[model samples]
Target: MRMTISTHDHVLIIDDHELVGTSLMLSLRSEGLRADWRGNAGGEEGILADVRRLDPGLVLLDLDLGRDRDGRMLDGVHLVAPLIDAGWRVLVLSGSSDRVRIGGALADGALAWVPKNAPLPALLRSVRAAAQGRPVMAPERRQQLIDTYHEQTTARSELRARLDKLTQREREVLAELAQGHRAQAVAERFVVSLATVRTQIRAILVKLEVSSQLEAVALYRRASGR
Candidate 1:
């Protein structure tokens, strides 16, 4: 069945390629929906400005935002959470099938992901669904999300269990270390000797079942929801 697209369902396409953005914008507008295109994400401020001005119902986002000033790939995944936080519904449209990237986008609150290679009809359907606040995901992608959630939950549970075994002093040491404190600094903060701080760090690592101080600190941050 054909999905009904409302005229008020305006969409913004953020793609690094001008041709791709123009093509998508034209196609979307042809369907009687208001559509616009921006060739780059333009960073947080720029994107937020565009969102405020256009008030798009949905953003059809390309995950690769081309290169940054540093020549690194400007990952659009970083924008998903901010866009959602700012009350924009985003639908990821990417050619890359990297599960980690896809999973990150889903976890970050993107409404759906439509492969860039998908037929225009399929893309339009996904966009319509997103505009109507209906979430959709491919079965395999859905399973991946489920598995990721379960894994994070299990890890958190295990981390909590490990933390339960920590002494009060050990937890304090971990908190300091997670904040990038050196053993010497921690010793000064706690008025303990450097040796004592190092000892606490070792104990923390053992309790957390981690190999090193860094690992212990990372686990502490994750466990503490920092």
Candidate 2:
């Protein structure tokens, strides 16, 4: 069964790639919804300009721009803040399957991240759901994301509680670990021996119950709710 979009809303698409954005624009308009296409939507100045002009009810943002071999310049990750700041409902439309990227987008305030190749019907359904002020993650992909999100968030909360048990030195070491600093760097920052930093890190990891520093930091960020 196909889900129908509410016909009265306006959706704005910002993609540097012409084919993908234009195709969606035409298809959506054919379904009796208002759609507009912008050549690109990144950078502070350009985004501000479009926000003023389009005043769209919803925005579909492609995460990639022309910066790599694949022509991806500004990351979609970078846009999340600005869009949220402008009070626009945004959906990330990207080809990237990196869960961290998707999670980061969600953590940064995007309503959902829909793959570029999702079925037109599903995309429209997501757009409509978002327009109606509902949070909509892709149904087929929701469970895995939900599980991972919960795990990361829970681990972070647990880490924060353990940090309360640590001394100020231990916390400084933990903060360094969360920032991806090496033991030697942490030692330098704290003016301690490298071995001391390593020991503190070991204690922190054990206390946090996380196997790796990356996971630890991910947990910490989730716990901070930032």
Candidate 3:
């Protein structure tokens, strides 16, 4: 499976599985691409150290690192923001079939994503495309990204229009909810009774034209773009 790309396209693989990384490295070298492997997705701290030391032109990453001490997901989504912020090109390679996870990673700034089951030639194409600064994504995933962008745009427009329909109390409730507060917590913070908070929340939901708290929150996030 050895197929190398180019000497200049130094690649670093961040995956928890040693066998997978080894196979990938060998396959990459076979194609003339210089590839190296690391055993960890590198907890946040380790990831920083690896990035600083490797300084690779392309990074192939696996998202599911299981739970660390904090019980947080260490998937590609978490890595995307840091990698992009540091100006690194990242390609997500994972066995997971979670489209939501894939979408989140792409939204956060991954250059490409390919399922591990993809053909070797397809993987090679993605690696080369990524090295050349071209986006590589499954057709369905690409469509999902477009749909998500459109949904957010529409949600934001709706949110803005709804804001004018909200009362002062409903706006206050929405603001706190948008900050990730639960209805109960918001009730406590505002020193309002639980029933009153529930009523305000229902009003806010109506004003936002959403049926559920999650929907309202999503609309708020889309409007805020954060």
lDDT of 3 by residue, 1-226 (tens): 5433468788888787889889988988888888888765447667757787665578887888665557675655677778767667888888876655666777777776788888878888889888877668666767786467556667667767777788888878888988888889988998988899999888888777789988887776756655
lDDT of 2 by residue, 81-115 (tens): 78777767788888877776677677677788888
Over 1-226, each residue of candidate 1 has an lDDT whose tens digit, in order, gives 4346788777889888899999988988877888888876456457667777666478888898887655666788888988877777888999877656666787787877789999988888888777777766766766676467567767778888989999999998888888888989999999989999888888887877889987887788787645
Write down the worst ten-residue block by lDDT for model 2: 65-74
* Number of the top-ranking candidate, with lDDT as the measure: 1
Model 1 TM-score on a 0 to 1 scale: 0.61
Q: What is the C-alpha RMSD of each candidate to the true structure, in Å?
A: 6.9, 6.9, 6.0
Question: Can you list the residue pairs that collide in candidate 1?
Answer: none
True lDDT of residue 151, candidate 3: 68
TM-score of 3: 0.60
- Cα miss at 192, model 2 (Å)? 30
| CA lDDT for candidate 3 | 0.76
